[model samples]
Target chain A: MDRLIEAIAATQNPSVVGLDPTEALVPAQVVASFADEIADEVEDAADRPAAQLAVAYFEYNRAIIDAIADIVPAVKPQIAMYEALGPAGVDAYTMTCEYAQSHGLYVIGDIKRGDIGSTAAAYAGHLGGVAFGAGESGPYDPWHEDAVTVNPYLGTDGITPFVEAATAADKDIFALVRTSNPSSSEIQELELAGGCRVYEHVADLVERWGQGTVGQHRYSRVGAVVGATHPEEGRALRARMPHTFFLVPGYGAQGGTARDVAGMFDDAGSGAIVNSSRGIIGAWRKTGAYSETMSAESALDLVADAARNAAIAMRDDLRAVMP
Target chain B: MDRLIEAIAATQNPSVVGLDPTEALVPAQVVASFADEIADEVEDAADRPAAQLAVAYFEYNRAIIDAIADIVPAVKPQIAMYEALGPAGVDAYTMTCEYAQSHGLYVIGDIKRGDIGSTAAAYAGHLGGVAFGAGESGPYDPWHEDAVTVNPYLGTDGITPFVEAATAADKDIFALVRTSNPSSSEIQELELAGGCRVYEHVADLVERWGQGTVGQHRYSRVGAVVGATHPEEGRALRARMPHTFFLVPGYGAQGGTARDVAGMFDDAGSGAIVNSSRGIIGAWRKTGAYSETMSAESALDLVADAARNAAIAMRDDLRAVMP
Candidate 1:
């Protein structure tokens, strides 16, 4: 988180472009480019669709990484999109994260994984590089991301292994506190016995989990995912968890504007990194201005350029409020 | 859940063997069997360990599935174990699940995955055969399982997608209510304003989520993961969510005795399916009685036999109290 914060500070931008390259968002050209390759690898007609899409998603992610690597502080790839493509999809995910980090952007694999006992330890090992054998940090040693998202339903037991492992690796975890969804209020907003909401209770724990890992930026390695859609709650949680960083999702396509997320950051503009997935990567789809004379390869270059411009615009939008 | 219960009835046992094949629990013979094959695939030495272990875990799981297919109704392969091995690990998981189902055992992928909106729907599509497309049920159909575990922290939005998709696919879900870990009480057992525990609140919601999906067994497709370690709470949750089936974990090796899990079931002993992982699959490691006359191949066979017998012993033990 300190490294992440430092990156944000260095770029003077609290934006992490989300790399959720779904089939619909992936350009038609990108899918076509991989069609022959996927068909060659998989003979079955049925298997080719998932394989082709999987390749397209990875190629699209790599393009997006190339587009905004110099501008954004980080990239958050939601694991579900890649997991849907099966093993090959996961391999793409591994490659995408590797690509993003190599481009000097922090990678947050939004896995949202949690469990109990050794199972939790396994997730920690997978995401944070803490193994349990003679090959303590096994063959996937450097493959672990710098940070990952975790669900906190099973309480401290579900979260402690991640924290311990992250602390050991100098990595970080962002617990789902106030998520950016319509029905988030269904359970998260329910008032507790002490009159605080359930999310507030989780917020308290998020702060506690980072007690041992405060970094140079005055932010704990532990962080919270406060939705940009909820400004008042974000403001309240910001005050509550002073040392914790924030990974504020729900920006752009999710109906959250820069003004909506302004309250999530500290006065110095370093406590949070806002995310926008379709808003940036799929920006090419929104604009029907590509010239007919443009080649497929050149069109893809244009798409990456659009993403780069969109990221820059987002950075400026956020800077307007946060800076 | 009705189909799951019916399968259990056919076997006269409510036991689901957990196939969490961590390296420590996987036999040395199994690991060695894959060594040559893994070496053949990768000349690079650094890649050998994970690839070897990944194959070993899958082979171990295939053997276990074959061992106990007829005795047990279902097998829950915790995805984290395979995920720790990277993409190949996930491929092994997909294969293990497919193997279990092919052998006529219900496969409950204990991949505790959850997220907001389309991401959650992707998980449902991967774990169950429902998707967010024109096919909604497409060519990538046979890949899904009978049921999967879900984390309910993100509330209705995160779970609703799974519920909708599972209902469409005629599959089921088991939401984490009270985990068996020692620190589970830190949040799940927290008292709400109405004097109901957080798990109790989740129980009420689980019942509500399953309201439209009651099947022939008078159980909802949406189930609850009530830890066998929590007898009193399980008893309370049982009465509260009468329609909800329970997938009880933490039996045997986790200190959950037959008596401890008895309360999770109804009078007919059909409302819950108890799981035991290490206590069964790794049972051979507990006993060093294999003679020198037994070759490595025969030793692996013995290990499978031990798992089959252990599963049977667990079923008999549960029946003693349940019946």
Candidate 2:
């Protein structure tokens, strides 16, 4: 929604929480409470256990959505975690996407899928809407998502399908420009013939691809994912692709402080969404907020509070600099 | 399995068929035959549609395996097509791998997955079996396959996890050195420092990765996927990665003929497997042998015959060139 841009501008906050929901990381009460309901229906389908697991995942995402709906402007779901569960996992992903959309929260699917030619089109089709040939209805319509992350290793052809589909769906795409991982330097840092690093070339290409999809907010639907860990590079990338939104990861648990991400924001606190996944979900566990006897719900409340406080701090930091 | 390799060497054939069972391409009889069984079972659980679909996929793969077991030494299954269906899709994939193994065929999973660090380990953990975590029987295990395909964009960190797991399982890996897609050159052909192209660097890395994993057949378990279209490059990469096996694609429907891929074979035909997916599975549709007058078994027989004939021709050509 265009209001997403306006929401960022209005609150001066560019923080987006990631709803990863790893089974091992979830609170014990949340697991204990949902286990019975899941067990009753899943007992018959023991062979396909992922279906039952998906139900719990969806519930967990819904709880997170409910808790942070007022604090954050969007939620980014990591597709790999859901995909590892199988189709039932996809079902949960789709449902969570719909739930997030209904709550006026923008959904960004962190699916780094890449392919070439018609296969790329198929992936884009599946992401955008229900594809005709790849079994029943497509999982999670692209229109429902405000944006999706894509891998750029296959180059323009790999990204074109997503560009075309996203343009048609009135959504956005965030290409992997610089990832937060320590090993990202391996290929991304390789010098090309022209002397620019691979990631820089990708950044330039992203800017070009975004040119055709400019929205009413003066930003294009194409965005770049520049890790906040590389603050200087992030600023350079932001300067290079001024019209493109930046989905900056590596915040919080990834060792990026809020102050480190300040350069990604525009003068009005626009064009960026800083993401924090583990730092938010596992905050209570790390802070010892829950006692051995405390309920999971109480611990979750503290976890949600920690996330809210973190977002507020980030928002305040950006405002102090940009205001 | 080593003896099997010796047999293939003696025969001078490196042609392997890929079983990519897309639903749209299935024969009408097979679809109609399985329709009632699927419908009846789908009544109880709507979420288990993939399970029913997987049954059809498993049957189709079984039929294809039965048809080509005598013609080829190995089979590659594109995991994406199966995964597009969901967990039942995964079920179909695992079942097909087991079936191919039973038929004395090496199974290569064409899942071009790559990630960084622990995430890469998670992927390898799923593909290559993991031992029990502490006291648990391990979170999930597929018992590992004979081999799996990987992407090298994330560099050595991405490959290290795979190497570790595959080494532990005594399995193999085929890294994406160069793909067959027309636009692959966009990133893959970029010139790096020291006058070497990106693909050459990747081939060099593959060579290094294979250093510790050489099998008794004079070829390493680590392999590189060199497109058959690039004959000169294929020969050069083969020379560069002396011990690494070359998994050549772009044969048949991709337009590189049997002659174009001959350079990939070692002196003894010890290190390459050319793949043909649509050329085999969709042969009946292409040759107009699946007309209304033709029986399902007869049409299937024709499809298998074409595949066997193609393989034989390829085999004869390779044998003719050997010293």
Candidate 3:
């Protein structure tokens, strides 16, 4: 959490780009360009389409990372988009994480993974890289994530392992406290017998989960994911969980505005970092300059430029609301 | 759900083998045997250890699948075990699923994935294979799973996509209701203002989520994951979620007994299927026949024989308690 806060301070930006690439987000020409190469390289014809799209996703993510690495403090790669492509897509996801980290940007992996105690220990490997055997020099960290989002439905034991791993690796984890989705209310907003919502209880638990692991930045390694969609709730939660930093999502394309997320930050405007996935990464779609007739390189150039501009706009939007 | 029910009836065994292989579970010689082969195959020296273990896991799973295919109706491969090894491990997970399906056994992928609407749709591609492009012959079904487990924390929108995908693919899904872990009660057992527990509310949602997708077996495409550790709750839930099926975990190694899970079944003995992971897959360790000097082939043979014996013993144990 301290590292993320410092990176945000260095960039003077409280926004992070979401590198959630899909076939629609990547340029068609780029995917087409890889077809011949993929055909020759891949032995199975059935695996070609997914393999080609996976490569295109990596290229698209790289372009965006290169374009916004300096302006943004972090990049959140949604694992669902990659997992949709299967094992090959998973390869692209790891590659994207490695690329983002190499560019001096904090990589917040939006993998909301949760399970039982032992299994959660296994999933915590995203933070503590796999020590395959007795090992060589050290563990091979295939998924180079600085922080990852976790689901809190399974309770304390499920999250404790992640907290231990994050503490050990000097990384951070954001538990899903209040999500940005509409149906989130169905479960998260349910009233408990104690006159508090489920999400509120979860917020308290998240704060407790981060107790011993608070960094010098006055925040905990266990952050809370408070979506930008609920402004009033975000403001209320800001007062409730003092030690838990927030990873605010659902901005831009998801209809979350700067005013909505304004109170999510602290008095110093450092308690939360807003994220815009489709808003930033798919900015080229909104740009009228993108043409189907353009070559792969030109299309990618457009994607990079549009993403940079969009990321800057988001930063400024959040800054205007900041104290 | 109909497919699973019929398969369970075919073997007269309401038990599923859980293929969750960990470093401690696999025989030393089996992993050691893959060292030289992986060294020659994997270009990155750092990746050899994990890659080697990944191959050994697939081989180990293949042996277990072969031994138990005739006796067990299904195999639930916990994805977290493979994910611990990174992308190489994920490959093994898919390969394991494909092999089990080829053996005429239902493959229940124990991936408790849930997200927001759009992201859930992307994750639903686990059931609905990725349609990479227009010209693709058919979607490359990379994840060869007949059914998958989903987390219901995100509520309705997070679950709809999986239900739709499972319906379209003629597959099924089991949503986590009351998990098997000790700390699961922290959230699941919280008393609501409406005089019911949080898990009961989720149970109703699971029942409703599967409404329109009911099959010939009087069960819906959606199933509930009720742990074998809670018999009273399981029995009550069986009565509550009538149309919903059950995929019970924590049967053997997780301190659950056949007597504890007996009530989870319906009067006809068809509502629930119990799972045992370590008690079956890692059974070779308890067998005194296993020696460190044994060959990889001999170790796998031991693993297979021990697994078959344990699985058969488990089936008989469960049958003695069944209706």
For each candidate in the order shown, give its overall lDDT on alpha carbons.
0.84, 0.71, 0.93
As for candidate 2, its clashing pairs are: A128-A142, A130-A138
RMSD of 3: 1.2
Q: Candidates ranked by TM-score, best first?
A: 3, 1, 2
Candidate 1 deviant stretches above 4 angstroms: A132-139, A290-295, B128-138, B290-295
Report how closely model 3 matches the true complex, as a DockQ value: 0.73
How would you class the docking of model 2? Answer: acceptable
The residue-by-residue lDDT of candidate 2 on A147-231, one tens digit each, is 7787776678878877887777667788888888787887788898889888888888888878878888878877888988988
Error of 1 at B302 (Å): 2.2
Clashes by residue pair, model 1: none
Q: Residues A22-84, candidate 3, lDDT per residue (tens digit)? A: 888898999999989999999988788889999999999999999999899999999999999
lDDT, candidate 2, B1-323, per-residue tens: 24336545544566677877776666656645655677777553443445555676777788788877876778888776665554456668878888988888878877767765655665675453443221244334342257788877777887888888777766788888888888788778889876888888888888888887777887776788888888888988878888888888888878887677777777765677788887777766767556766665665567666666666766666566543
- The parts of candidate 3 lying over 4 Å away from their true place are A133-137, B133-138
Which of the two, 1 or 3, has more TM-score?
3
Which CAPRI quality tier does the interface of model 1 achieve?
Answer: medium
Candidate 1, residue B215: lDDT: 95
For candidate 3 chain A, the 10 contiguous residues with the lowest summed lDDT are A128-137
Chain A of model 3 scored by TM-score: 0.98
Top candidate on TM-score is 3
TM-score of each: 0.96, 0.86, 0.99
